[model samples]
Target: MSYPTIPAYQTQANGAEKLSREHPVLDFLIDHQEAFDTGKMKTEPYTVFHVDDFVFTKSDGTVLPPGEASWKGLLEGYAPFNKHYHEGRYACIYERNGIWEMVGFANVYANLLVPGEKTKKDQSGRQWDVLVPGAFLFTCVKDPTGPKGFKVKSMTLFGDGVPVVGEMMKRGMVKAEDLVK
Candidate 1:
C-alpha cells in the first residue's frame, strides 16, 4: 500500500522518510484520513504474528519453511546474551483527530542473569534463573501489519507482561513517552 507523501525534511539517506514517534502510523494511514477524522474507520483487534513464522527464500527463489532453530538463532543473533521469547500482537490502528495511531501489544521474555550476580547463582549460591518479562507496543508504517516490513519504525516498552490502560505509571523501556496516549 502506498503511504502518504512524506515531507522533504523527514527523508533519510535511503530516501524512505522516518516515521514520527508522536504519531507513528499517521503517514501510513493517509489513505483513510477522511474516515479516521470522521471516526468512521473500523479497527481490527487480536491480530497476531510471530517472528519465527517467517519463510526464507534462496537466491534462486526456493522457499524455506520456518524452523525452530532458525527462529532461536535469529533471537540469539539479535540479543546474543539474552534468550528471547516474542509474542507479536496487534492492539489496533485507529484514526482520531485527523491522525493515525498504532495500538499494538507484545509479550517479550528475556532470560537474563541478575545484575552483580555471577552464573545465575542465588544468595544461597545455588543455581537460580530469571526471566525478565517486558510489555511492548509494536508500531509500524505498514497498512497491514505483517512480516513484510523489514524496518521497524518504533518499539516502546511500557511494562512487564500485557499492558493495561493508564498503566504508564510503571517504568520499563521508555522510548517515546508521547506514544502512550
Candidate 2:
C-alpha cells in the first residue's frame, strides 16, 4: 500500500534544526540516523556512538547483551517491517553530571510486506499499516576519543508490546493460535 508523504516537522517554540546546531552531538546523531536509513552507511548507529560497555534495555526490563549478536537479533526481528510514515512528536536534550541525554517520541506507522519463513501463513503478505509509536532514551557522554566527540552508555526503548501484538492479530497479520504454545 502506498502511504502519504510525511511532512517535515518544525517546532513552533524552538526549531529542531536550531537546537541541533546548538548541540553538535545531536546534530551528528541525527545525520548518522538519516544516513543509515538511506543505506549510505552499513554500520549501525549504536556502534558509532555507544561505548564498549553500552547496553540496550527494552521496555520489558530485558537488558540485551552488548555485542554483534544482540544487534543482529534486533535487526533480524524487524527485517519484515518497514516504516511507511513517521513524524517526530516531541524531543528534548538535557545534561547532568557531564552526561548528555536525549528523550524523544515519534508517531510512526509500519507495513509488514515481507514475512519471514517462520511467520504464520495467515500473517504473510499482508498489505496493512500498523501504528507503531516510538519512544527512546539515549544516555551518552563526551568522549574525546570517540566518534563525533560523544559516546552512548545505554539506550532504553519504551513501548507496549502486548497492544502491538494484539493489533496485529486483530488485523490478521498475526495468527492468534501462533502465539499459543
Clashes of each: 0, 0
**Per-residue lDDT of 1-181 in model 2, one digit per residue for the tens?**
9985433322212332222334665665566445544544345555665576777777777788885554554455445465333344566777777777777665444556543222221122333455566777878788886667887677777766565576567657779888895
The true-versus-predicted C-alpha distance at residue 126 of model 1, in Å, is 21
RMSD of 2: 10.7
TM-scores vs. true structure, each candidate: 0.27, 0.64
**Candidate 1: residue 178 lDDT (0-100):** 57
State, as a TM-score between 0 and 1, how close model 2 is to the true structure.
0.64
RMSD, model 1, all Cα superposed? Answer: 17.8
lDDT of 1 by residue, 1-181 (tens): 9986533212111122222333344333232222322333322211222232433323233334554443333233224233333333334555444433354433333334222222343222343223233333333334245333322233334443223111222332223565575
**Poorest lDDT segment (10 consecutive residues) of candidate 2:** 116-125
Error in Å for residue 64 of model 1: 36
Model 2 bad stretches (over 4 Å): 1-21, 39-46, 83-86, 115-128, 144-147, 162-173
Give RMSD to native, each candidate. 17.8, 10.7
Q: Which candidate is the best by TM-score?
A: 2
Estimate every model's Cα lDDT from 0 to 1: 0.33, 0.58
What global local distance difference test value does model 2 have? Answer: 0.58
